[model samples]
Target chain A: MTQPTYDSLKVGDEIPTLTTPSVSRHTLALYCGASGDHNPIHVDLDFAKKSGLDDVIAHGMLSAGYLAQMLTNWVPQSALRSFNNRFTAMTQIGDTVSCSGKIVEKFEKDDEKFVRLELYSNTPQAQTIVAEAVLVLA
Target chain B: MIDKKHIGYNFPPVTIPVEEGRLKFLAKSLGETKAIYTDPDAAKAAGYPGLLAPPTFPFMLEIDALDLVDFMSVLGETLEKLLHGEENFNYYAPIYAGDSITVRKRITDIIDKKGGALQFVISDNTFTNQHGKIVAETRTNYVFRHQ
Candidate 1:
């Protein structure tokens, strides 16, 4: 996929939206190993239930990764300047997460061209994460 | 109730060695197909020092160094009632494979809301590379429910 060059982007332009494959317990476990977050609420169903959750939940970082993937897929890896998110809600297994972003501001700082974006991730039901980021484009 | 006195507490620093193999694994787990994340040559072509750690890859280093149980214990909180509420990462510079980065964590805020039914603990972490250059700062918020 060809990414958008910095010169081609405009403030208020929407980046392409991406829908992730349904999250699974297996994927959660893999993330646990890869990310080193072994929180029982994310892996142990019984523990999650005891913690007032219906079932084991996906790691917030997993959904955050989906948002990052959406950006890196459209922008070069080197262009990423900063990424931030608020995990407002829990993501359970079997939920398909969708991510989208819009260019909100563009400017030059320190002789660098940068674009700021408002980002989000949601399940079919509601938005689960809200984020904002700045990307440097060559 | 969480101890407000611990708000300014700082944990010991942890130095982590970023490895290419680990970066590859993390990228694979995310189903990332970016060559710069998995191939050192591709990363160099992209102007990185080596295999580039994906945006969220620092979670591995941060989480490993963070002993949650100990952290919560110090605040008079329990693990079972905890949930991740928020995360923010601000990058001052790119993190590359083979970089030995040091992470220093500190509790910055504690808030009780909903008549104390929920408590939020916010922490800030600073990442410094081997040369003592500030690489990134991450702020995390954890929500704890009262039983």
Candidate 2:
């Protein structure tokens, strides 16, 4: 997809959403190894049980990565100026996540046009992340 | 409660290479299907010199450069007791596979919330490529939930 132009975008415009498959244990383990985030709370069932959770949980970065994918799908990775997110809830196993973003602000800074997007991701149960991203417009 | 004195403490910097194999592995792990993230030839076709580091890939670099267990121990806490509250990344330049990334981290803030039931630890990490160019800056807020 081509990058969105500054004159073509409007505030409150929603970008295309991206959805991913269920959060399986296999996915979490793969992320643990690939990301080097060996936090057992995400992959070790016994550790999660000892930590007072009934079962293991997904990594927050995994969902955040999904949101990133959503933005990159809309704009090139090079267009990204900043990306931020708050992990509001835990994403559970077997939850298929959907990510969406809307343009919140558009303005010119230092002769460069930019758009700020309010981003979000949710499981079937509840919202897991609330985020914002800024992208430079072509 | 974490000691406020630790605020502004800087961690020893660590540098690691952006390996192509790891980038491909991460892309696969995230279920990323874009060839620009997994194939060098495809990336070149897309005008990228090499496989582009997917957004949030720096989190992998951050953790790989710093041991979370040792980082938490410095604050009198453990990994299991902490939860990710918030994360922010500002990009200055694109990071491609084969770049050497140097990470410098420092504790920026530590405060209590919920009347001490929860403590928030805020740290900022600056990532610079081998050319001495700042590529990205990440701020992470960790919630220490007291049992």
Candidate 3:
């Protein structure tokens, strides 16, 4: 899995699609454990039902987590320059989500290689463009 | 209906080191067998310095940097009244291992929605290494519910 130098990338290339299962209670728990974010909305089903969501919802970071997968696969593991996104809709249990991105621009700045991406996280009922990002690679 | 005020609210930036074990654990949970996130040698083979973290990894660091937790914690919007309405991110650059990030966070927006409430915040999450190279920036949103 040798990473390609940013020198070879071009505009319009579709970044790979990374998929993760729905926002199961387990996903939130695992995410909370890994990330140390213990918001109960992501854990307690009784609490979620009370909050008006059908059941426990996934953490926004977990949904965004898939996008990170896309980047690690596309560039070198750490090649991801920056990862930022808005927490759009709440993705629930039993929903399948896909994370992907496409190269929007490419150029050299400050004598460094950089690529711009329009990233997204989509479910059957929702489509969210998490945000635009710039990745600097070697 | 309850009111969440954003006026004159902000949080001190939180700086943290990127931990490799956590990324490795996340890759496993994601069922991702990709060597880049799993193996340092593999990532090195892929042209990285070491175990490169996932792109969304910053959220873990930025999440606590927000004033929302302390804000909402005091609002009585307990998990019983909170809902995650939406999320979006703006990336500044790629994040690498051994990098420390300083994020200045605060609630920037508060809105009302049918059947729920919306709260948006700007986590001026900036990553600067010991050498002062700004590695990346992250802005995020957090939504709540109405009871």
lDDT of 2 by residue, B37-129 (tens): 989999989888788998897777888888788788899888778899999999999899989999999999998998999999999999999
TM-scores of chain A across the candidates, in order, are 0.94, 0.98, 0.87
Q: Taking the candidates in order, what DockQ does each have?
A: 0.78, 0.91, 0.45
lDDT of 1 by residue, B63-140 (tens): 767767767778887889888888888877778998999999989999998999999999898999999998888888
The best candidate by lDDT is 2
Of models 1 and 2, which has the larger DockQ?
2
Q: Give lDDT tens digits, candidate 1, residues A81-123.
A: 7888888877878999999999999999998998999999999
What lDDT score belongs to each candidate, Candidate 1 first? 0.85, 0.91, 0.65
Q: How far is A13's C-alpha from truth in model 2 (Å)?
A: 1.3
Clashes in model 2: which pairs?
A: none
- Candidate 3, after superposition: displacement of residue A113 in Å? 5.9
What are the clash counts of all predictions, listed in order? 0, 0, 18
Best by DockQ: 2
Stretches of candidate 2 above 4 Å error? Answer: none
Off by more than 4 A, model 3: A1-12, A21-23, A77-84, A105-115, A128-130, A136-138, B1-10, B13-17, B40-50, B65-71, B74-103, B107-117, B130-133
Better of 1 and 3 by TM-score: 1
